[model samples]
Target: MAPSWVNDRSYYQEDCPIYFATDFRQIRNSLSHADYRRINGGNRITLSEFYKQYHKYIMLLYQNGRELWSIQNIEKIDLGDVTEFNRMIFE
Candidate 1:
């Protein structure tokens, strides 16, 4: 099956966070802890570990609606595993 988080073009305009809910919370930053929690509600990712390699011009966003935080990248790092993505953001 296709990647669950790989929503098609239509998903782009979704204002609700549930569309990306499963994945976004996995990478949420502590700087946005409260806002993330508020936006995410108690509907957090309860699934087993899964990861994606996100190489963006920015950290873009990992929140629900309006972005709670933003990170610009002058450098890009690709972690082949989701666990690495976790470490890169949290550590």
Candidate 2:
């Protein structure tokens, strides 16, 4: 029985455990209040939008010491496939 947080959602599938580290304050300070609201309080943005806004912070697996199966590109990522690959590698 997986936890509720483990369930799939429109934003991201839970099968792959995504991880990222960033300076929240820096990101927040860079955005205007309205921009923040548009990103965080409105309908989800498309993959193109995501790449445009966050590509600088993106990192794929093994980049910057990230573990295997890490995802950097949101536009072409398949979380389910990443999860299965991770399971095969670790098991």
The CA lDDT of each predicted structure is 0.40, 0.45
Q: C-alpha displacement of 1 in model 2, angstroms?
A: 44
* lDDT tens digits, residue span 31-63, model 2: 544464444534444345555554434533235
TM-score for predicted model 1 compared with the true structure? 0.20
TM-score (all chains, Cα) for each model: 0.20, 0.24
Candidate 1 lDDT by residue in tens digits, 19-60: 354355454542255445444334554222213323110123
Off by over 4 Å in 2: 1-42, 60-62, 66-91
What's the residue-level lDDT of 6 in candidate 1? 53
